[model samples]
Target: MAARILAAALSLALAAMPARVAAALDMAGVFDSTGPEITISWEYLETPGRKAEMQAVIDGFAAMVDNEFLPRDPHAGIEIVMTDDAAHFASYMRRNYPAIDIPKYGVFVSDGRLVTYSRSGVGTVTSLLLPGLLRDGYDDLPQWAVTGLRTYFEKFYGFWETDAAAGQRVVRFAHGYHNPWRLQDIRLLLPDLKLANLVSDTPTVDGTRYQSQQRLLMIFIWKEGKLPAFMAALRARDRKMYPTYLEAVFGQPLEALQPRFRAFQETILAHWNLVMRTPPSQVYADRATFEAMTASVWR
Candidate 1:
């Protein structure tokens, strides 16, 4: 009788066990542990070269995010779903609403689901947003910070030239200098900017251009002769810092900096036209290509 009762109890306990765990178990509050694993559905995944290229992009984004933002306050195990089409992008965002917002630059999402759509041949983290601001974890970062970060990335990591003598980097337009942006630019504002915003928006005011330019200006102020003084001012974040730093760094006031900036711009344009005769490669179809090309260029 005792053995029978024990056996019945064991059977009942076994019956209570679930056949499968919940499919949506929250992991670290950012990801759904039970949801499908994050994937990079690149068409080129079958090709060894393409697969590696896609993997590098994933790795780059992870590095960029980790270096730029997440270290301060890592949430849950966030997963990134990389898609190449508008249909997939829309589906991903819709399925992951409240956790996402498409901004003027790119899709800004929380620990929930997020997707980066890059039709551009070369997908780079610098082109998306500055790693610094992302690292800083500023969801509502000022316009200056956004532009500053963009400029910083282009100056350092982009397939462009930076000249201390010229002081400004010439940004080649996708259509022309006047045209808004090319496929590369799209990566800069994916998942966030609506089609209308992309069409109408111009680099004006304290917008993208200003922020970008400010980065160069900041670099000029700090790295050049006025660095020590500029650092002191920056630490304070004082309104007067701009003027004092500007004077110390450039030996000119804010009003005087524009013409100098223009001069630098002209020098850059002339130099860009002279040296960059060939258009840079649009897509790094695989990692080897990117590695081969950038191996010498990037450290």
Candidate 2:
């Protein structure tokens, strides 16, 4: 009798609340906050310090997006949910987003919301929003610009320091991991891998490689102080006409650029070697150790 009474009272209380508030309550033990560009909600597991740090990262990310990518303010503010438990998050997401496949660590729901099930540490908060940002901004950008800019911002948020130093590290990593095939050989292997093919929403292996190549190209442009002009050109023209615009901006034909691309690859390799020789600093104290412990859950 007492249990029945308690259940009735609970239902009645929920019925009295606004629909949105009631729905929010269904995902119990969540804390919500509103920022200028985003609304964030997280599991109760987040400590005060961590929450503040995440907010700061989000603010910084928003500033970068406004200044670099979007010509107008976003149509809608983004929503973010950080879940403490992976299994629980997955179940909730499956119920809410039945059509989308949920990744183990993060997912961007169709409703312009980002959901992340893992939190490595303070420094890594930017990564949690990246997949969603990439997905959201993809349609508005040209194929070459999408991954290149995404990588550039990733390095920015990951390092949270000066752009030049972060860009150098990103270029080095891309160079170190790239295949040793010549430009002609790569072109043959990925014959259909043109900027037009990247318009498809589905992910593919060839597409991934194309994105990497674009990243390398962006790094080269950045080093040459031509990135701003390149980005302006991208914004002013349509994706189909990007190749023509590219040649115009660089004042060279595609064939003429191959030798310079090869030289850029060699420079990246040299930078990678130099970076690998340097030891890491312990500025974050035990943050690295904490991140390692949480790696299995996220990474």
Candidate 3:
């Protein structure tokens, strides 16, 4: 009777403990590096050559942030986690950060940590580094702008595999114009959806497509030497001020620019149709599947 009572008491005590305290991770063969701007925690032991290759990728990413993106020194350096087992990594994150939300693909936590389970590659590196840079450099920018900058970087500097038989050499902008058909879908929806509403609203599949269009629009504005002023207006954080800013930058009122923008959109669609020999509408018609996937991941 006495032994049974003692065992019951111990079980109760264990059950009362916090989940984080109860769930301790035992990571094996983890390798870590602390650089000036980023700290990488790789969850696998790497050989000397592999370590050198990863180090070079990290260094290149740091240099890009320091030179092109970071307007000021980051208050806390970014922490990055690379692992093959995303589910396991997410479980550990949940234990420590009970109140915080974890994104399906890596996320930038409030405390300057970027945890990811992405395979080591140029695309993954770009995905992780771009968010960190945007978070550090333009923390006050709206989500649309932050996401736009990331897509812009990927469109210009990212790589894609061409031939599986030829090993892993990647070519830049391999998708050609960064999701062109998706941009057409956004253009088709624009008469019903306003730009300001699209930016400020919760993310949906259509909203995601709108964001891609906005990014392309921003890139076009940048090419016309108007991005600096436009970004300045966004930094002011007044939605009402956008029309005036748009006029100043584009030399036309918002309504006038729509017709011009529509013309530009048509030209892009025509060019892509000529190259790919497919209608943009038919190509991007599967909205239901895309929305379901987005909802599931975000949920």
Q: Per-residue CA lDDT of candidate 2, range 8-99, in tens? A: 11121111111111111111121222224555576546655544444434443344334444443334555566666567677767877788
Candidate 1 wrong stretches, greater than 4 Å: 1-77, 94-108, 118-145, 151-263, 272-299
Ranking by TM-score: 2, 3, 1
Which 10 residues in a row give candidate 3 its minimum summed lDDT? 20-29
Q: 181-286, model 1: which lDDT tens digit per residue?
A: 2223333332233212211235433444344344544433333445445434433444364334344445555555555554544443445433233234342333
Which scores higher on TM-score, 1 or 2?
2
For model 2, the stretches where C-alpha displacement exceeds 4 angstroms are 1-37, 49-53, 85-88, 98-100, 118-142, 151-207, 238-243, 269-299
Candidate rank order under lDDT: 3, 2, 1
Tens digits of per-residue lDDT for model 3, 83-103: 445575577668767777766
lDDT of each: 0.33, 0.40, 0.42
Which structure among the candidates has the greatest TM-score? Answer: 2
**105 Cα displacement, candidate 3 (Å):** 1.5
Candidate 2 residue 232 Cα shift, in angstroms, is 1.8
Q: Return the lDDT, model 2, position 176.
A: 13
